[model samples]
Target: MHFQEESIDCVDFVLRKDEVLTVILGGGKGTRLLPLTEKRSKPAVSFGGKYRLIDIPISNSLNSGFEKIFVLTQFNSYSLNRHVHRTYASNAVHQKSFIEIIAAEQTVSSVRWFEGTADAVRKVLPYIREQRPKYVLILSGDQLYNMDLADFMQNHLIDPETEISLACNAVPEDQVYGLGIVKTGIGDSIKEFIEKPQDLEQVESCRQTSGQFLANMGIYIFNTKTLIEVLEDQSLTDFGKEILPKAIQEKKVKAYVYDGYWEDIGTIRAFYEANLMLTDDIPKFNLYLEKTPFYTRARSLPPTKINNAIVNKALISEGTILNHCEIHRSVVGVRQFIDHGTKIYDSIIMGLNRYGSLDRQSGKIPHGIGKNCEIRNAIVDKDCAIGEGVKLLNLKNVTEFEDEFVRIREGIIVVPRHTTIPDGYEI
Candidate 1:
């Protein structure tokens, strides 16, 4: 079936007639997105209320007309695994199109898990090479943005002689130190490359080469032969350290400058800020566009209902019922029930399951927050039951609060799943 192309900027590029395989690097222990990432892997972390981090990349791949994707994970892959299975179930129409979540356990050679970004791919080297695709697309599963990768790949394949193509973007000097910075040489060929500089001087020197420094987008396209040769070399393991630099030295590396809405959701603040971007009046990243549509496990639920209440800049997922609640710049996940007389601002309320009445209710679920409650600047995980009159206040004056059930991380309150907090408790 043909997908919509509204969101993506159409590029003029012709792709080769060959089967393509995509490998998504998703195993990194997202210590940065802490608390929220404390339970699942980075890619599994919920974003924009209903979608996970993996959905961004996976959706992009499918929308771009490439299939047979593999998600490589090491740390906390349970949620990631379940999501791919349930969301992207096997399809007979696109028999060749499939999204597989392959963990470190599925590595061909050793039983030990993936070590680094390059090591992760190295472990799965054999499996991917066996696919025999003309080109390989490498992507990171923890970023936020939308791009037409087909355009990038088309540029890469322009010269059939070229081996490695890297999608690059300009990042701030302070942030470019940890990533691979390239100095474009002759004909878009990279001349210099650095992997995570140790000092400010090195960063400055690297920045001087290009007026606008180019940082790797954590996305790559490699010729099947080039990948086989690089992976076969026992001396070379990591991409940033061994393969990429060597390819640059050999004058085989090419760079594609990408000026789009791409962000690395590396920390809790960054993650929250990125989510907040979706609520922008004119968001940097628009999911409503017909083209470049972001695909997700479609929840066959009814549309949302706003009852006489004013909601400004909020993302309400399908199957959610909001009644007389004022929500501003927040995200409400699937099947959630926002009762009347509740005000939520700058927060995220995940999936709320309505089971049988516990200490008894009139058939309504006590799983989520109750009426007359006010939540501000917080993230409530799935299946949490917040009683009436509860206030999760993140005011400037209040630095920290001691609550047994609630977890406060860096001043951000996190209410875990199935947690029951008494009414009138101020967190």
Candidate 2:
């Protein structure tokens, strides 16, 4: 227990930051994103060339001024643990503020692993209860969005009847089937949480005149007592699938309509598209917001070195060396080495630990992309070694693939960490 009772007491005294105890779920085995989640948790996976997925919610909480937080992690949580511990230490002014990691542990009372989102919280309710939280702000680790939670909390405070407040997004009609659609009745209270309502008529009924249906963002704010009551039923494992729908039936749940950019980068294809979206002329989810900046571990390395590189509409991270490569609409992460004559477009090159030329010469192990390669519509993970003249075009236009070092999911080839496509290999 890194959080002391004294520190919790300090927050309790303060009128701000104590009302809500933000609980961010560090996702389950991200099977959709296979090899990437092979060694690290989903939250620990790299995003936007610099920040990790967990950074999004943590930054949102800190930005919202919620100091007392806990991240529930399962499955290969080492990297996520290290990141939260180092990046989110106590603030200078508020020495009591902290971000703690609570990995699912087996105890005598319960030996079962986290069955789902609700179950994860149910197992750790004891610790959360100790903090004496008025409300519990449930967040997803892999969601890319920005919202001032103060607004959500304030809405709950003002509306005393609403026991649960759901952050709902106005999504396009096309995506209404993919999300948990909400139908709010009179008094702005959500009447039902429709799980993937298939019929067009059902979707039309949920629309809000903006030609977009009100979709549940999977962001939940629960009154501490109500959440505990709901979780007391051991059968309820997931929120969207079980708890929220049940709550809508029995309790007063309100829809906090949010009109903003939100992307769930859980699957490989979604992750690929979201990263490339960052390279757009004007990304829908802008990271350069001066007022509220996303927080991450500060790796203060050297500046990116571009030597005779033809770059356009790209996001190049720090400490990368692009030598005579033609890159367009791509994201290059930290400490990468792109050799001369490589043409990369609409791709994500998650950078390496160090230069790879020496290792390749010694026949030990290759690291970065070698000379004269052409890659397009792909995601190359960290420490990947692309040999000289290698072509990762997915020439066959594969929608799904699994090979020795490459994986194609939904037409996007993903090379996980430490993967080495040998010299002259063509895909």
- Scored against the true structure, residue 56 in model 1 reaches a CA lDDT of 93
**The CA-based lDDT of model 2 is what?**
0.86
Query: Candidate 2's residue-wise lDDT over 1-427, tens digit each?
Result: 1222232234433554656798999999998887789999999999999889999998888777777889999899999999998888766666557788999899999999899999999999999988998999999999999897777777777778889999988888888777899888886799877888877687677777767788888898999999999998999999988998898889989988887899877788888889988888789888998656898888868999999999999999999999999999999999888888999999999887666464565875467888999999998999887889999999999798888979888899889888878888888
> What's model 1's lDDT at 196?
72
TM-score of 2: 0.93
Task: Please state every model's RMSD to the true fold in angstroms.
Answer: 3.4, 3.6
Q: Extract clashing residue pairs from model 2.
A: none
Extract clashing residue pairs from model 1: 4-291, 5-290, 5-291, 5-292, 6-290, 6-291, 7-291, 367-385
CA error at residue 93 for candidate 2, angstroms: 6.2
> lDDT score of model 1?
0.76
Model 1 lDDT tens row, 1-427 = 3344333344431232245789999957887665677678988888887888899998888777666788998788888888888888877775656788877874345766776777788788778867778788999999877887788777887777788999888887777766788777667877787877676566565564445578888899988778877776666667887778787776488888888988887876677678877898889878787667777777667777677776888898877777787889998888777777889989888865453343534644377667778988788888787777788886553534546677666666778666777767775
